[model samples]
Target: MRDAETVTFGGSALNRAAELRARPDEIAALLNDPAARAVPLWRGKPSIDGAGALGWVAANHPVLRDGEEPAIFLGSDETGPLFTIDLSAWQPETGADPVPASFFDATEQRHPGLPDGHRFAELRNIMADLSARDAECAATAKALIGWHRSHRFCSACGEESGVAQAGWQRVCGACGAVHFPRTDPVVIMLITRGNSALLGRSPGWPEGMYSCLAGFMEPGETMEAAVRREVMEETRVRVGAVRYLASQPWPYPSSLMLGAVGEALDETIILDPNELEAARWVSREDMARAFAGDHPEIRAPRRGAIAGFILRNWLADRLD
Candidate 1:
């Protein structure tokens, strides 16, 4: 993918000053600095400004102070330091959807002090609208927030943990164990023949929508091997000569998608009964029609998603 960095959430220019994360004095000074800004997440929804862009506020905002733990060091740009705070329990204007207690809806909220006309919106609904910088900040915030929420206990000692390392680590008081945020690796491949690409639709995906075969990386598997194995398992295609192309940070709950292009040694469709509802080879012209929203039987993935970015770039002959 020639312009792979142009893919959404792939090309953030922030200098993540990791050295300063352990310097409490410096970080505290940053918190007090007038130019330091904070991005707030309320139940996974981001604070959007009146202009429909990612919104930032003074680090000293009251809601930021209300956060239970120290803010995560999101890094710094030429302007100043950037930070992320999770106020999921803060009094929002009713953010959670009416889904059962087991489900969550990030878009269901309104912030009182959001700039006029600003509202909290789900990342998926607004990812394509954000600048690359803003998208990086939001992804960072959502990922860390989700991890902290679910990993409140220590795995080693079965004890509660406390935030540490400027929110990059969790320290268990009982066992002195340390834990860090995790990024799950996923392989999404563009398996192609002369003029056709293999696509599959998972169960319950939107009608007519299909994307490249994808699966989680195993404990000791290589990226190239994962790509080949996933394609074979999902669609019974024998993929060879795999090459990595690009990557994207998909922060639904913290995932790094590794994009690859592979050669199909054999073209045979064998759908795993549990993995997909349908799998087929789509011709170039048909793929182009799907991109243009004119295909009667296929629809492309949404823009900003890794699958969509890979598919469109493949259609344009830019994956070389």
Candidate 2:
């Protein structure tokens, strides 16, 4: 757990000046300040240069004209006031548009108003390559903006809501209801018995891909219980003691991944076809080979993901 925050999308200590969220006067001044820089996101993709750094534009950049709403303040870094603008309203050309419901979208869209090499790229493709601060800001931006896009109505009255609290919340004019951004809790655990770790592949995962068993936490369920229940439900593997490990902010929509380690009570494998396509216990030797690209049947875990981070630490006996 000592290296908990070292995971990708970990806290970067960005000063998220929450106090200014309530002050419209100060927010207006910051928007006009020359030092204000905005990170542009298009359809959930953050604009980045060819070199993997976030593509930051001046607050008044013309490309921001395509944004569906006003920029959401991220926080202050070394680069003065930082904000994120959602340009999902902009449409890409035919054929070059993103592939719908694909596992990974490799296409990049370049706006005519932005400089060369600045393209809105998928966050997963470059998440590991970005600096800590960039990753943190990008994750926050995507989650916050995505929330605004989906939760435009008040659940209390089914009426339209207006942006409030600098995009951190929405307020319904009809019912005086205030709703805040939401992050669902998910438990991704490394389950082990003896010298092997339990890994499973979902139905749509890439061929040969396997990862720690994970599922969303249900209401009134504890993290420990979630870990045990998920493992049992997916592979029918009974897990005993569960211990908290590291965590990562997984903003592919919005989720906080709670990483844990669980001791399997038995090594039997019974796949629940609905939850997993395959499940197996992999020995340390075989897992090391997979990580090194030498295993024929098992592919290495994706870099920058909590599963890989946890597995690598478990292999090196650094889970302390």
Candidate 3:
């Protein structure tokens, strides 16, 4: 994981301006500055122009609603003033009696003013051809917008909340509580024993698609422990001595994938059907074939995803 921060969006190291979020004056300064730009959100998706999808901000100044202000200024890249916009004032551009699209998926309703690519997909398949910078922008946009949608209610008081911290936090007027966007931690591991690795398929995955075994890290669990526990719980493969490999900020609603390479003490898989449709051991040779698209029955993981990155490195023997 030495080059972890070097990975795609992981590399940006944006300062995320946490301290500035709480100060109303600082937030106002950033918003009113001509250099400050707003990244548009349609439904929960980030608006993408061509260039790989991550960096574009909305051209218009966003109007704040309900006494809420911006929170969470995701620090600067080479771009100037990389601030997020919270449109609690958003109303569907649809017909009379328009409502917020956050209540449902709005990927199909293309806004006439926005770029065609400014939308969401379950997988960022479009990023396959985008430049590194665009991909980072796309990832940031998706993560922030999704955070806004899910945090409309205050966790502390269960009262309806409004955006603050630019677009990174929510505040409840009822009990004077504040909430911030959450990035759930998940552990994805390439479990290995000798020359083979473990991969599993979820019930609804595309035919022949298999990738690293992953599970969410529970509260108070260390990254290494989460790796071992998840591997054991899903495939009954006891793992020992987990080693951190790399990570990806999978912004499909905000998850930070903690990728690792784990030494499997035992290989016999007792798959919990509820967790996987099938679990199996694949030799390095077969994995290479899958990577090359030569395997008749299996497909390697999709590129730009953490699973694919892990598998590619494992094949290159770079995980060491």
Q: Which numbered prediction scores highest in TM-score against the true structure?
A: 2
lDDT tens readout by residue for model 1, 1-320: 67888888886888888899788899899988899999888777788887878878889887677777778889998878899887676665443442333223444466665556666777887888899899988998899988998899999999999998888899999999999999999999999998999999988777898988899999999999999889888888899899999999989788999999999998989899799999999999999999889999999787789888888888888897
Model 1: CA > 4 A from native: 91-106
- What TM-score does candidate 1 get on C-alpha atoms? 0.94
TM-score preference between candidates 1 and 2, better one: 2
lDDT of 3 by residue, 223-281 (tens): 99999999888989999988888888888779999999989998899989999999999
lDDT (Cα, tens digit) per residue for candidate 2, span 93-195: 7766986588888989998888788999989888988999999999999999999999999999999999988888899999999999999999999999989
lDDT of 3: 0.70
What is the C-alpha RMSD, rounded to one decimal, of candidate 1?
2.1
Q: Candidates sorted by TM-score, descending order?
A: 2, 1, 3
Error of 2 at 209 (Å): 0.5
What is candidate 1's CA lDDT for residue 251? 90
The lDDT of each candidate is 0.85, 0.92, 0.70
Ranking by lDDT: 2, 1, 3
Q: Which of 1 and 2 is ahead in lDDT?
A: 2
